[model samples]
Target: MNYWLFKSEPDAYSLSDLKNDNNSTGRWDGIRNYQARNLLRDEVKVGDLVLFYHSSCKNIGVAGTAKVVSAPYPDPLQFNPESKYYDPKSSPDKPRWVCLDIQYQQECIKFVPLPLIKATKELDEMILVKRGRLSIQPVSPNEWNIIMKLGKLVC
Candidate 1:
């Protein structure tokens, strides 16, 4: 299955929040960017693995692993006028955004911070290290292995 990195602000929805969700699973919603939305709708699939990265925080890095439990579906938040992610241009028949359901897998014993990732030559080509702003990004198997090793988590 394809591997991916899913970034979230710890203050908004941290890995801990996912772990604490009912059944340790929840819908991954609120993706607004076109590129990120496309990835979620097209590339991401159920059973794919995800590196849960905590961004816009003091320790930005892959904090845990999660497994996609559902296929891409229209983001319900987009249809809700009260949601911050709501899109006036989108409708039930034509959705502009998509999301997936992911189940918490395992939290890292030690978070692999950005500095550590940047120091590793093998991870030089990672989109995250390249300052990519997309919330959902594909990850190479090698990169996934390296990050898992660094985070002290079983791959």
Candidate 2:
């Protein structure tokens, strides 16, 4: 299964929020970027692993784990005019956005703080480095392996 990373603002939706959801699952929506939307709608599949990264906050890092639980579909928010993520260009007949549902798995117990990632000599070319602000990104196989070796998760 393909591996991926998704970033969310802690104040907007934290790992705890996912854990507390009914069934600990929720749709990942409001993606405005076509690239990110494509990843969710066309590539990500159920059982795929996801790194829940917390961005735009202190201690930005991988906060927990989650797995895709549902098939991709047009993001409802894109059709809702009231939503900040609503897109006027997206028509129901031709959807311009997509989303997925991810089920919470486990927490990392300790933040892998962004600073640490930057300091890691091997992760210099990680997508997170080039696309610092993309809400969703594909993690390279090498990058994933390096992160797994960080040993920062609480035992």
Candidate 3:
């Protein structure tokens, strides 16, 4: 299965929140960027692993792991007018956004901080280190392995 990194602000939806969800599964939605949306719709799939990164928080880093548990589906919030993620241009017949479910795996034994990742020579090519604004990013197997090791997580 492919590896990915999914970012969420801890205050909005932290790894802890995901772990506390029913069956430790939650919908990953509200992605407004076309690039990130495309990845979720066309590339991400069931059983793929996810590095749950906490961003826009006091402590930003890869906090834990998760597994994609569902295939891509139209984001329900896109049709709701009250939702901030709602798109007036999108409809059920033509969805402009997509999402999926992910189940919490395990919290990292040692939180791999961003500074630590940046300082690690092996991760210099990682997307997070190079261009990190994307909310969802593909992670190479080697990069994944190194990050897991840094987090003290079993691959």
Over the stretch 1-155, how does candidate 3's per-residue lDDT look in tens digits? 99999999999999999999999999999999999999998899899999999999889999999999999999999999999999999999999999999999999999999999999999999999999999999999999999999999989
Stretches of candidate 1 above 4 Å error?
Answer: none
Per-prediction TM-score: 0.97, 0.90, 0.99
Candidate 2, which ten residues in sequence have the lowest lDDT sum?
146-155
Query: Model 2: residues >4 Å from true position, as ranges?
Result: 151-155
Worst 10 residues of 3 by lDDT: 38-47
In angstroms, what RMSD does candidate 2 have relative to the true structure?
A: 2.0
* Residue pairs with backbone atoms closer than 3 Å in model 2 (clashes): none
Provide the overall lDDT of each model, using Cα atoms, as 2-decimal numbers.
Answer: 0.94, 0.83, 0.97
Winner by TM-score between candidate 3 and candidate 2: 3
Residues 37-122 of candidate 1: C-alpha lDDT, one tens digit per residue: 88998899889999999999998989999999998999999999999999999999998889889999999998999899999999
Residue 28, candidate 2: how far off, in angstroms?
Answer: 0.3
**lDDT (C-alpha) at residue 96 in model 1:** 89
Worst 10 residues of 1 by lDDT: 127-136
